[model samples]
Target: MWYYVIPALVIFGVVHVYTKSWLYILLRTWRRDLKALIRFSKVNYYLLKWERRNMTVPKVFVDVAAKHPHKVAFYFEDDIWSFQRVDEYSNRVANFFLSEGYQQGDCVALLLESRPEYVCLWLGLSKIGVKAALINTNLTGDSLVHSIEVASSKALIFGSDFERTLKDIQSKIVHLNKYQFNENMSLSKTLFDNAKDLRVCLKESPIDAVTEHIQKGNLKDHILYIYTSGTTGLPKAAVITNVRYMVMAVGLNKMVNVQDNDCIYDSLPLYHTAGGILGTGQALLCGATIAIRKKFSASNFWKDCVRYRCTIAQYIGETCRYLLATDDNNLVKHSVRAMFGNGLKAQIWKPFAEKFGIKEIYEFYGATESNSNLVNIDSTVGAVGFVPFYAKFLYPVSLVQCDEVTGEPLRDSNGRYTICRQNEPGVLIGKISALRAVNQFTGYADKVATEKKILRNVFSEGDMYFNTGDILMYDDFGYFYFKDRTGDTFRWKGENVSTSEIEAVISDIANLSDAVVYGVEVPGAEGKAGMAAIVDQTRSLDLEQFAEGLRKHLPVYAQPIFIRLVDSVELTGTFKLIKRDLVVEGFNIHVVKDEIFFYDVRTKRFVPLTKELYDLIMQGKVRL
Candidate 1:
C-alpha cells in the first residue's frame, strides 16, 4: 500500500509543477485575447482604430441592403419588408424629416408599433443625426408627456390609431410639433412601389432630401434615448452611445455564438431596450436574420419558432413560465437551437431547454444604462451544457443588515457597508469611477430626476455610484442571480413576499392570461397587504374557487387581500404591467368598474367587496 501511495504522490507533485507552468502560459494568452476583444468592442472610443475601414454601422446597413435587396428584413404573419424595401422606406422617411426641417442632432419622438414604418424610421433617423426617443405608445396622460418632455424632443410622430392617447397628453406635450404617420402621408400614397412585384427602391426625391446633419459624428455620441422598463419606479431614459451599442452587440453575439446564418424569432416589443438594442442590434450587426413578431403569444410561440426555422430568440419576465403552462404549446416541430436573452429563472432553465430541444441557453445581464454585463457562455463546444453568467459588475453586493424599518443601506462597526457573504441576497449598487461606471441617463439632463436616481459618495467622501435598486445574489460558483426590486419587495407577517413570485403564481390560475400583484394599505397590518388584478382568458375569474385554490398554494400572508377581475391588465408597450395604475385604482369601485372581492380570512373564501361592506368591516360591523 505504501509503495503504491508513494508512486501516486510523486506523480501528483510532478503534474502539479507542470500544470502551474502551463496555467501561467494559458493565463497570459487569455489576457491578450480579452484585451483584443475589449478594444474591438470600443470602436467609438480610443480603440476605434481597430475597427475595419469604411465599415461604420450605417454604411454596414447600406451595404447589406444593396447586396440583399430581396432578403427579408422584417416579418409578421404575412406582412414583409425586404432589405431594399426597408432602406427605401427609411430613405423616404429620412427625406420626409429633412423636408420638415429636422436637422442633425435633433431629437424625434417615435410612438409607433412594430411595423415596417417604425423600422425604416429608426434606420432613417440613424442615417441622419436625429436621436430617436422611442416613446411607449401605451403611456397616457402625465407619463407620456413626461417621457416626451424628458427627451426634449423637437418633434413627435405617432400612429393614427393612437389619437386618443395623443389627445390625453395634448395639453402637456412641450413645445413640440406633432405629426401623424397615417394621416400626414396620404392614404393614397403607396408605402412601396406597385410596379415591382417583389422589390422596390427609393425614387429620386421630389421632396427636399435631408441634408446631412452630422458629416462625421463621433461614435461616443449617443443616438438612442432608451427609457428604463420601470418595474421599480417612473422610467428613466438611458444614454446608449453608438460605441456602447456596438460593444454590447458584438459582446452578446460572440458570447452567445450568434452567426450570420442564425435566425432570431423576435416576439419582444420594439420599444423596450432588449427588443431594439440588445436583441435586434445583435442580429443586425452579427448579420443574422430577424423574423419579427408583433408581440408575444404563448399559445403560438412554438408554432412561430417552427414557421421561421429560428435558431435563436430573446425573452424576459416569466415569458417562459407562460410558455411552459401552455402544455401543448411545446409540442411542435421547432428548428430552434439556441436562445439569447435575460431574466430566466434557475428553476425553469433546464426544463425550458429540454422541453424545447434547445441546445444553448444564453442568459445575460445588462441594462440600457449599465456598462457591466455577464454572459453565460459555459456550454461545452458541440455539447449540451449549462453555466451561469458571472461578473462583479463593478460592485460588491451583500446581504448586509440594512435598516429593516426604513429600508436603507446599513453601516457596520467599520463605517463601511457590510458585505453579505456568498449565497446571501442583497441590493446591488454599481461602483462608478473613471475605469468603470454605468452609462448614465441621456437626454437634456433633468437634474431633479437624475440626482434622485444616483447615489453620491457611497464608498468614499466624494465618489458616486448608480443605484440599480435591484436585489441580487451570487452562488458558490460566483454566478449572480436576480432576486427582486428594492422597495417593491415586501414582507408579509413572517414570510418574504416576492411581488413577482405572486404575480407568476396568480398568472397560473388555469384560465387567467395575466396578473399584476402589488401590496396595498390595510388596517392592522405592519406592512401593506397583497392584492392582484388578473385577466381572465376563460371568460372571467371565479372568486370563490380562486380564493380556495390560492389558499391551497399560498400561506396566510401570501394570499392577496383583494382580488380584482379586469377585462385585461393594462401594460406598457413593452408588456410590463403598469402597477401605478393598478395601485391607484386599488379596488376602488368608483375608479375601476371591475368586480372586487375580499378574502375572508377565517373561512378562506372570497366575498363580494362593497363600499358599505368595506365600511362595515373596517368599523368592526362585519366579521371575517
Candidate 2:
C-alpha cells in the first residue's frame, strides 16, 4: 500500500503542473506578455501610452462644437441642448470669470450637482487655464471648508438649490456667485432680472470678440483639482492634468467600446473621479452622447436605460446590487449591454451578467492620483487590472512582520523591504515621485499630518512610496484584490481579522442591504472581538439559520460576536460606508436606539443584550 501511494502522489504532482485551466479562459489572457501576444490577442485592447501628439480635453469639446453644432449634446426630460448651445453658454461663463479678473493659475470651485450648467462652468474655466476644483455639496461645515482651502479656489460657482450650504461657508470664499438657470419652468421677465442671461451676455460685442480668440492650455498643466471621497479622514485634493485625461480617454473608450452612436446613462456624482474626470471626459472625447441624471435612483435606473437607449453605463458598489435586488423583470429589456467602473464584488459579478444579459464589464482600478491602472478587458472576476511597465506596477503590499506585540518588518538576511507573499493580504502602496505620480494627499490641516503618509526607502535606500493606506492582495499573475483598510482590519485572538473579508461573507444574508464588520476593544482580552452592523432591521433575525450560514463560510475569529441592526448605513458623499460614527457610538446600552444583541459561540445562538452580559464581555469575563 505504501509503495502504491508514492507512485500515485508523483502522478498527481505532474498533472497539477501541466494544467492551469480556468472556468473562463479569456480572463487569464491578461497574464500573457503584451510585447509578444498583444497583436494576436483580442483581450489586449490598449498599449501603455496612447499617443505622442498631446490631445487636450478642450480640443474634444471644441471639435464637437464645430462638427456637431446643431446635434443634441445633452438631454433631460423633454429638453435638449446642442453642442453649439453648450459651447455658447460655457463661453459666456468663461467670459464672466475673465471679466471678473480670474486668470491662468486661479482656482474656481464647482459646488453644483449634475446639470448642463456643471459642464458650462467646467469648460468655462478650462478656456483660460483656470482649474476647476469640484467640491461635493453634501459635505458640511469643516469638511466643506477643508475642501475649499485644499483647492485654494479664489472664486466659487454654486447652484442656488444649495443656497444654505453655500451660505454657511460664504464668508470663506474669495468671491462667490449663486448661478440660477432660466429654464422653461421659470422663464419670467422677473426671473431673468437678477440672474445673468448667458445668451444675452454672449450676444454682446465684448464676449463675441473673445470667442474669436480662444486660448489653448498646456497639455501638461493641471486642469482639474478633485478630491478623494473621504470616508475615514479628511479628503485629499488630487491634481489631474490634461495628459492624464487624454490617457484615460483612450483607455476608457477602448475598454468600454464607446462609439459615436452610443448613449451612456450617468448619474454618478461629477465631483468624484468616475463621473466627471473619467465618464464625462471620455464621452465628450469619444463623440458619444450622454444622458445625465440628477442622481442615481434604483427604481428609475431601468426605465432611464430604456428611455435613453443607453448602450453603456457606469456603476460603483451597491449601485448595481441595489438595482439587481429590485427583482425587476424589465432588467432584460434595457439596452445596457456594457457596464464599466469598479467595485463589482464576486457575489454579484456572475449573477449581474446572467440576469441583465450584460456582455461586458470593464472593472479597472484607477484613482485620481494613481499613475497605474488595470482595465478588465477580458472580463476577469475580482481584478483591478494592469499598470503600465514604466513603474513595474508592483502594488506595495504590507506584510505582518511579527506577533502583534512588536511593530517592525520581519526581515530576511537579504535586508530588503519585506512584503506579503503572493495572494497574502497586506497594506498597499504605490511608488510616488516626479514619475508615476501619486500626488493625491495634500497634507491635512497640519503639514506634519501630511508627511506621516509618505513611506520612504520602500524597496531600496532613498526611494519613496505614497502610502495607499488600503489593504490588498495580489495573485501570481498581476491581478489585485482589495482586502480591507489598515485601520479597519483588527487583531482578534492571535489572528489578524479582515473586516471586509468578514463582511463579504455576512452580506449574503437575506434583507441585508449592506454590512460593516469591525472590532470592539474588550478589557483584559488579548485582542478585540469582531462585530457586524447589518443595514436592514425591519425583518427579525433568525439566529439559528444565520449562525449556521456564518459558521460554514468564515473562520472562528472572523465570525462576528455582536450583531447590530441599523435602519440604513450612513455613507459619505461617494457612497462609501461610514464607520466612524458607529465606532464612536459604540454598543452603549442606554444611548443606542437600535436593537443590539450578542452571539454566544458556545450556545451557537444569539442572546438578548443584557447589562450583565455587556459587563462580562467588557471585562473579558465572557469567552468568545
Candidate 3:
C-alpha cells in the first residue's frame, strides 16, 4: 500500500509539470492573482471610507495613530519614530506655529530636505490648517524668492542645511519669518529655540481646533502649496488639497499592496510630489516604515536598502539611470521587491527590473497639477499606464491630434477636436468638471497659468478638458506610451521628430550615461536641427559606429545633427534635464567648451566641427 501511494504521487507531480490542464491553469492563475485582487479591493475600500467620512490627512494620521500607536511610521538615519511619536511631534509643531501668532489659512514656506522633521512640520501645518509651500531647497536667488512670493508665504521653516542659501536671498524675501529645522546658528535662531521649547512645554495642541478645520475643509480647500519643478522656467505654485494628498497616499499604497511590515526606501527630496506627497504619503497611509534618506546616492542606495531591510523603493528615471551607471555591487544587493515612480524610460525599464531583481515596476503617469492618472498595474515594459478593456468606458482620458507647428490640438470643420487614431501620437487630455469626482484639474496658483491649460469647446460646444501638454500614443491593447512633451517635439525636413525617440536611439547606440536631446535653430535650416548633449563617462565613444547606428535606427530628418560631449549632464533638483543653457549655446565650439561633433552627410560619419566647417554651415554653403 505504501509503494502504490508513492508511485501515484510521483505520477501526479510529473503530469502537473508537463500537462496544461484547464482546471490546473485556472487554479494557478487564481492563486497568483488573488493577492492583487485583494489589494485592489482594499483601494476601493479606502476610497469609499474617505468618501463616507469627510476626513483630512491629519485627521487620518490621528486615526491611524489611535489604531496603531506603537507602529513605526518613519525611519531616518539611525532613528525611528512611531505613529504616536510622529503625531505628538506634529502637535508640538502646530503649537509652535500657534504660539508664534500663526493662524488658520496662513501660508508657511517649507524649504527643507528629506528628514523626519519635514514630515512633522508638514503634518503639523496641516493640523493647524496652514498651507505649507514645500519650496525646493536647491532653489536660491530670484527663483527661490519667486517660489515663496507666489505662495504668499508669510513664514519659512527651513532645514539647517539651507542656511547659506537662505542668507543669500535673505534681503529679497519680504514679510518672512524664518525658523531653521536644526542647528540655528544663522537666521531664526530664536524661532528654532522657541519651537524646541514649545515641543516640551506643549506636547499636544487642541485637537478640537484641528477637528473644526477638518470639518470646514472641503476637498477644494488648499492644505499644501507644492511648486512645480519649473525645469523650463520659474517654478509655479501648485495647490494640493488635503483630499488630493489622501488620494495619493491611499491610492499608491493599495495599488502596490504595501503591508504594515514593509519598509520603503525613500531618497527623493521632500519638496517634490513623488517624494513629499506620493511617496511619503504612502508610508503614512499604510502602517509602513519609510527609510528616509537626505538625498539619492547611487553608492548608498542599496546599502541603505539592505541595512534597513527595505522591500520597496521609489525612483525617477535619472535616479535609476544613475544607479545603473555606478560600478558598485550595491545595485544587486537588497530586498527591494517593487519600484514605483514616473519618468522611467522604455529602454531602461526591463534592464533595471531584471538587474535589480524587482518583481514589479508600478509606473504611473500624471503631472503636478493634472488630474489625469494612469498606473501600469501589469508590468508592460515602456507603457507608463494601462486602461483595461473593462475600465475603458469609465475613464474619460483622451488623446487629440496636435498641430505640428503650433503644438496645439487640431479641430475639425465643425470645431470639434480630432481624436488621434490608434498608435498615433497626440496630446493627452482629461475631461474636467465639478460633476466628475476623479478628473478634476484644480490648476496652479496663478489663474492665468491655470486658464492656459484648459481647452474649451472641444469635441462639442461648451465641452472642456485639461491639456496634459504631453504627446502620447496608445496601442491596440490600451497601453499608453509617452512619446514626448508637445514643446519637445520639433519639425525638421517637413517631418516632426520626437526628441525622446532620438534619445532612445542614442542610448541604444552609444550607451550614454546621460543624454539631453533638443532641437536647435541652425543658421539657414528651415526647421530646428536636432542636437544632443551627452555625458559619456567612458570617454571612449566610437564616432563612426555611433553615426552608423543612428542612421540605421532613425530617419534622416530625425537623426541628431550635432553631438556635444560634456563632462557632466546638468540636471534640476528633481533630476529633469536643464536644456535652457544648452539651447542658448547650441553647437558653437567656442561658446561650449565641450568637444562638439557635426554629422558629415557626405561622409556618413561624424567629424569635429572645425572653424572652416562651422563657417560653411553658418553661411549656408553646406546643406544639413
- 1 or 3: which has the higher lDDT? 3
Candidate 1 Cα errors over 4 Å, as ranges: 1-60, 63-70, 173-175, 183-214, 229-233, 379-407, 412-415, 433-445, 456-463, 488-624
Candidate 2 local lDDT, 1-624, one digit each (tens): 789998898886666555543312324444543532342132223222322344456765787678877776776656677787777777777777687678787887777778766876777778777888888755655557777777777755655555566555556653544344333334433222234543344446143414322444666667887765322345567767776666666557755567788888787878877888667775456567777888888888878888888988888755776677776664548888898887677768888788788898878766665544556666768776643222254333343332121122334576555677667766556665553322223333335544766667767888665555555667655567765545546655433465765676676754466888777765544355788888775756676788877765555666788888888776556233367556656677667787787888689887878889988877757866
lDDT of 1 by residue, 466-572 (tens): 55555666653345676555555554442235576567657665456778888775543334568887886464566777876665445455678888877776665
Assess candidate 3 and give its TM-score to the true structure: 0.72
Candidate 2, pairs of clashing residues: 374-385, 374-386
Residue 208 Cα positional deviation in candidate 1, in Å, after optimal superposition: 10
| Model 2 misplacement above 4 A | 1-55, 67-72, 171-216, 229-233, 330-332, 386-416, 433-453, 488-624
Evaluate all candidate structures by whole-model CA lDDT and list the values in order: 0.61, 0.64, 0.75
For candidate 3, lDDT tens digit of each residue in 313-384? Answer: 998776887677678444556789999987777777887787888899988888768777777776778888
Worst 10 residues of 1 by lDDT: 192-201
Model 3 RMSD, rounded to 1 decimal: 13.0
